[model samples]
Target: MLNSLLRISQKTALTLVFGLFSGLASAQATTYYFSNSGNDSNKGTSISAPKKSLAAATALAKAGNKLLFKRGDAWYIPFGLFDLSNKSGTRNNPVIIDAYGAGDKPVISNLNVLSDDGWENIIGTTTWKHAIYGYSKALRLFANGVSKYKVNTSDKLANETDVDQPHEWFIKEGVINKNGIVYMNTGSSLVAPKNVEVLMVGSKPVVLMENTNYFTFRNIDFRGGSTSNIVNIWAPSANITFDSCIIQQGAGSGIQAGHSGQGDLTTYVANINILNCLVDKVWSDYENDPNILLSGDGIFMLHAVEGGLVQGNKILNWGHSGISITSYILGVHGVHNLIVEMNDVSGGESAYTHAIDMNGFEGLTTHNIIRRNYFHDYTVTGHILGSYNQIYSNIFAGVTVTKMPRHSHQGWGVDWAVWRYRGTGPWIEAHHNYLVNNTFVSTEECAIMIQDSKANPIAVSNNVIANNIIYNFGDIAIDVNTNVAGTVIVQHNNFWQENSTEPVARFKNLGTKDVYNAAELNLVLPQYFRGNTQFNPRFTDVAKRNFTLTESSPTALKYGGTTQYTSLLGEDFVDYFGKKWDPFKPSMGAIQYNGGD
Candidate 1:
């Protein structure tokens, strides 16, 4: 009897344990569907009966639930998406927001249209006015899905009677007890207020993740935002991801992630991945405020981010820099271990911007990698401004198109600058950077330049530049300051200037006010110069911007050995066009010269 009782107790304990795990599994399997045609009162567990709004679905969400929006549908939320604060998921079972039953991805915009009868004509003028109550400020105005020009003067809405352009608008903000007004001159006798929409900047983002963790968003089209980016992930959040999405048309950045306050590295947003997305048109003509620093960026990893990956994104037509990894705050913990690879960034001539800019405080930012990307048609290719950063195997081209008409600075292919500010903390300088195995072509001025913009004597030091092919440069091929002479290494590079009379390298002495050429530079700093030759790289095409090497090119065997660079870049890494590098002997430039020479 005693043996039978013990067996029964053991069986009951096993049954209870199994029941607890089964309950937890069922709780995690809850899936909610959202559609425009569904009713909210029904159970939202199936596609047949779905929820109608994000608020209802958000209220029912748990740690591992999936919230799927039906494709070919549009939702306009006046306040943007739900605020995902303190609503998190585990690493294995993250909260998901995606599309289903697709004809196209679901569109989520941040605007509210006025009714047809919501407009009133202003007295003795062709302009019409719409009064909006309880909103803070109007950011952008759209008529029939087209952006309108905003008047610069704030007094034009209340005082001007001769505003005649159909696409011009003005916003008069509210005072202590008044309502904000939006005025527009449609220049038509019949006013269609229903076709007009306004995006308000009420300190909200289209999709906000603050202090939340483990969320994945995929295949959603996000548009029409104001103050912040389309998707903003603030700090104390980790493992947030965005994949295969279209993010565009914002007054601010496209996608921004960062941490602020007290400079604590422990509170950083960690492991954020943005992959395979289309980010375009991230600037607005109405954003003329000089105080707004975070505008028109394709992807911005702001002051503090750790282990972030931004890869495979096509960024086009941005008004400012394409990808900016910056830590602008003083005494803040800087961005660390961020990898940016395989991106195609192109900008128009109207906007003078850099393809990539890494701005950070010295000794705080380190170990960031930039590799295998194509940057074209920008005023500057890159501004590498951090310590211990490695930039390799990339192409920086097309700054010579129209000479990017700037008054303050000359256009260069790659610029390395250091600035030192007087502070109580450590001195800021650019040191121990590696720029190797790259191709630079068609720059207006020098192909590569290093200078202390603030004119600090010892601001830049201990950098390496090796195994590059510089073709079709305007002025000097390589320009370095004299203060960084003994500490920098310039070796194993091929250079050919568009003007044949220019020197292969120029070392400017800031203190003595003298310049040194290739032979003169070799005499002064013989230890820093090795195997640098002046040769034509023999590119396949120059006018059409095809930079592949010809079979007879002399640069095919110019790289000396791979023993020094292979340990910096790991053993298994591909070249620019996905060709493997020979471990014993690699080619000179970004392309690995697969054809026989």
Candidate 2:
């Protein structure tokens, strides 16, 4: 009996000792500080004794630790921090990289500033020459913190003017072991070498994470990458979050996640969050190359990604698409369940670009949600080949497709706000997509298009376009080809044209048939074409792009009521201004008018 009592006492003591050690281990998670003025030999636990470089801090970092950099300083990380791979943190305690002090977010860049005296004036011309490196064809140059225009060759310098100004540059190749010369012309002004910076392009990303999980990067400025992506989260990476970060001036994309090489479901990247971020000025070599369909994008998600959230971001000046979820390899399950909402995008600055390009591997992208986004001054809003996607409550304005003079043989025609065209591959049809409660205003072309060439075998079918406000479109309201006549159901919407005595809702080309009158629409598709009204929506301001309805508008109070496609609209009934409405009695456009009639 005494021996049994001693064994129980020993077990209890061992348990207590283990608990104490676990608590100590949890408390030992440290906060490493980084500053431009500190030394690597100093202890990085405190701000006063901080690590001088990202290499020093990353070497000593463990899971559940914080890596904080000084707010006003900057670091030139030519080689990325590769030690972050294979790091995992717990759910409650994520490995965070954030700013510590005030001023600005810490800048991590690959841009090298040029010296002031290295420039030599080219005699008898308004140009200057500077030697950067040995004959590299790809160099991203910025003058006075702005991306400069790169001409095709030195002979085309005079012809390559930018917006009525003569500011362009060209690069000359050098011999082996010799430096290449960069020629610059600023319209007769002397070039300042100190104001210029360059990022040598050799496919080097700033942040490359492989199998890293549960990491959060906040309030950091990542810029000037010469690679395909500025921040790349490789395959099998999960739970990575980027909040309030500025990702700019990449040769390819701002952020590219997931692996195009992975095939298995378990090896897919998952739960990547990009919130409240600004991605600007991502350019690539393929942007102007007409032979290549891919362009430099704002955010590019590769194959085998699931359950990611991209919200409250501003994506601007992208060369191709603003956001792309793509899969290249066959037999791979594509990107799905990505909630992209409340983002402001302006793109299509390069050849044949769309705002959102989901026309990747056929039949792989499914169950994606694109809601409440504001797209303006772009060519196309969505070039979708995906299925079972929900696109609702979004505003598409100023969709003007630019005509490229170089690719004039291609005849880059106008496109609609949302285009559901034929897929590139076999057995992949665009089907079962939903577009509900959206607003289209001041578009250069039509509002919505569901069409394809007759040669494609796959049929676009089972799509629903309901409860939308198509107003002030330059061309037709809804254009559906004869090939997809009976497939799409268009109903319960308000359509109006600006400044016409007879507001003939120009919903046209349902198999080459135009339905100008409501009675004609009812006669064409009698069962589905109910409650579609053609009247002025009575907006508060059209110039300011505000689509809020007035109190006396009939579409706001009377025409919009119960929808037949209730289940198709997602659970979120919030409007553009963040006001909730009853799902059963939803209003016509993106904004639910709350005022009494």
Global Cα RMSD, each model = 10.7, 10.6
Q: What are the Cα lDDT values of the candidates?
A: 0.69, 0.67
lDDT of 1 by residue, 1-597 (tens): 111111111110000011111123335557888999987897888899988887786675556888898999877787667678776776656788888995988877777666668888876667888877757466777776566656653433343244467767776777632467788887865663457877776636777777777778888888766565777888777777888888876666778888655546456677788877888754334433332332367788887777867777778656567888877666556787888777777664224567887867765567788877787777654777678888887888876432323322456787776555444434445778888888898888888888764345446877888878888777677787665543677777777764333467766753433544444454566677766666677777766666666777774334442446678766435566656777777777777876654
CA displacement after TM-score superposition, residue 217 of candidate 2 (Å): 0.6
Give per-candidate clash totals: 0, 0
Best by the TM-score measure: 2
Error of 1 at 182 (Å): 4.5
Task: Write model 2 residue lDDT over 1-597, tens digit each, in one string.
Answer: 211111111110000011110112346578989999999899888988998887876675566789998999988764343347777665656788999999999988876656668878666566677786643454567766666666652334433122123346666667643457776665564654447767765647778788777789999998877557788888777778899999987767889887858455447777888888889864433335443334477888887787788877888777667888776666665788888777887763454456777754466778887777777667654655567887777887777655544422211112222232334444444778777778888766667766654555556777777788878775567766555533666677777885433333344445435545544664676666666667788877778777777876774433474466565554464666555656567788887787753
Summed over model 2, clashes come to: 0
Off by over 4 Å in 2: 1-27, 79-83, 120-126, 153-166, 186-191, 262-266, 282-294, 348-352, 360-362, 405-424, 453-458, 498-516, 556-561, 567-570
Best by lDDT: 1
